[model samples]
Target chain A: MLTLAQAQTIMTTALAHAQSAGFKPLTIAILDARGAQKLFTAQDGTSLKRGEIAIGKAHGAVAMGIGSRALHKMALERPYFVEAATHAVGGSLVPVPGGVLIRDAAGTLLGAIGVSGDTSDNDEAAALAGITAAGLVGDTGA
Target chain B: MLTLAQAQTIMTTALAHAQSAGFKPLTIAILDARGAQKLFTAQDGTSLKRGEIAIGKAHGAVAMGIGSRALHKMALERPYFVEAATHAVGGSLVPVPGGVLIRDAAGTLLGAIGVSGDTSDNDEAAALAGITAAGLVGDTGA
Candidate 1:
């Protein structure tokens, strides 16, 4: 189980990575394995919709049991996949680059994290860094 | 009508109840009648998944007009019901005991609350206590 403390630490580290990279203010959302929300916060100056976007990404990752990066790739190759997932997950499946899953040392899926604010690549980089900082593995969705 | 203050109070009191019982850390989420998020937070040591479970429970309760405990019981009696709900609701329904409906003295539904992290029974107890503390009615979904 990825405790809230770990989730917060991951989020904080993710934010720091974004700041270090000179990215814009970001919104972060994390969910447990059961798709429960463990943590969420939006940096000041970010658009209101960033939170929803973050949630969409995180939920998409959780529901599909894959990273958003993978979903993004599939969506790019097959647009219908996005539509189907959106319909299936209540429009929360955002095929983006920032949503990734957290895995423990034994390769257990602990939860997911989504980041928004910067470009998709930047957001993803920040999120991956955050997961690594939390001593968990972050898949690239490949 | 549900205010953010009231939502926060309910979540806070819910956590207090869990703490009083020496239960595990928890996450709490509340939404208004329209299913808009009112407030959410996780205890320090709780898992990240608790928040999402709480949300699913709360959303499930609101969408079904019954407590999650009721859904849980129904799910036990009818397994296919869970699949149908997941499809109809876009996968947010969680047939768990932690989701409960909040009503006013006049029996008007103000919103719903979802709690997670501890055992389902403990989560339900904490959520009900919080509702009572907020001077609202907490339906047990029976």
Candidate 2:
């Protein structure tokens, strides 16, 4: 189980990296292995629905047990399957690079984190940085 | 009925109020009179589901044509009716104090704002303050 402290560390590090890189205002969501939201943040200037997108990215990663980067590829090669999965998950799946699954050193699934606001690649980099800063491995499914 | 600028004003003011009052991290949602989302923000470290709760509060207010405080009383006094209404609104109704209806000086409904993070009363207070700061009237259905 990912503790709140760990979740906070991930969020803090992610935001710090985004700020240092001068990315756009970001929204981040962290979900535990059970797919429940653990922590969320939306920067002051984020546009509407960024929060939902962040959550969807994280939620979909957890629901499908794969990083969203993998889901994005699946979405390309198997569009129908991805669409069905999106519906099955109540339309919360956003196949993109920003969502990454989190695992501990022993390869135990911890949770997932989703970031939005910057380019998808930049968002994914931020997620990876956060997970690494927390001493967890990030599975981008790449 | 509300512009994005107005929505941002409400959000900024609401967050300012929450901070000055030393309330917990908050999540806020602003919805137009047509029930479309206008803006949303979740402070860093907000708990899971707060975003939904905030949206539900505002969405329910806009859908029912009343503030969520009134909805709370309705939920208590006519539980079945409120339950049916909740279902009718696609299960977005959250009868609580933090949901408020926004109106112009001419008493035209412009939108609704929902807040979550602190006690219900404090949440409501923050909502009202935000609306007032935006130069709008807030109907809490009190």
Candidate 3:
């Protein structure tokens, strides 16, 4: 039951982290536990494609119940899974490092956040900061 | 142009209208001009089905460049067209009521809004109220 306000707080903080780090403009997507989109924003100047890619990353994280960083690693070690998963979601799945799950103090899965428009690692870093700033945990699979 | 604040305002007001009208819990979806989802929220007690249906309605309205009311009428008059269009979008299209386009004063397409819960007429009424409340034009097609 992550409220929309909470999602916005998390996403805004994520964008701020990107800003502070001098990262390029980023797009952020948030999805609730049901895999329903809660919020999405592509900051000014981001590429036209960033919104969908960011959303795909977040949707993938939620669908797999794991952070996208882990998926990226798995994709590297077992590329076949990536191909199959991508097709399974009708091309909405993205195996990347920018998607992360948000959890409560009790380790309940609330939702996920995905950031795009920078290096995958950097995008993950921003998402991590945002998740923490909103008083939640981000499972980066680290 | 449609700012996130404006989108939020519209969605919140739509929910309020539903609340006032004593309608069932509703879900709302807002999309930017490029058909990128900007915001989506399901009220506390809405059915799980509302989430996807709400999104589908909004996506369809944007793809067709008109309000869902018009699409609904078209579906009644030309069922085959709706079938082909739905299949075309990989089944994301919902040619039903409750989706409307937002436009600026100069008639520029800003985005679209979708609401689900209660009857289709009620949903469209709430969406239109929200559009008007936010000072945007809704292409309800009458």
**iRMSD (1 decimal) for each model:** 5.1, 6.6, 2.9
Q: Indicate which candidate wins on DockQ.
A: 3
What is the per-residue lDDT of model 2 for residues B1-142, given as tens digits with 9 covering 90 to 100? 7876687788879989999999998888888887766666666667777878998999999999999999999988999999999998899989999999999999999999999889999999999999999999999988
Candidate 1 Cα outliers beyond 4 Å, as residue runs: B1-24, B29-40, B44-142
Fnat per model, in the order given? 0.26, 0.02, 0.26
Identify the runs in model 3 with alpha carbons over 4 angstroms from their true place: A1-5, A19-23, B20-22
lDDT, model 3, position A141: 61
What's the lDDT for residue A74 in model 2? 99
Every candidate's DockQ is 0.17, 0.13, 0.34
**The candidate that achieves the highest lDDT relative to the unseen native structure:** 2
Relative to the true structure, how large is the alpha-carbon lDDT of every model? 0.84, 0.88, 0.84
Model 3 C-alpha lDDT per residue in residues B1-142, reported as the tens digit of each score: 5777788789879988998999997888888887877767776656656778998889898888988888888899999998899888778777788998999888999989988888998998999898899888988644
Clashing pairs in 3: none
Rank order (by lDDT, best first): 2, 3, 1
Q: All candidates: CA RMSD in angstroms?
A: 6.7, 5.2, 2.6
Best by TM-score: 3
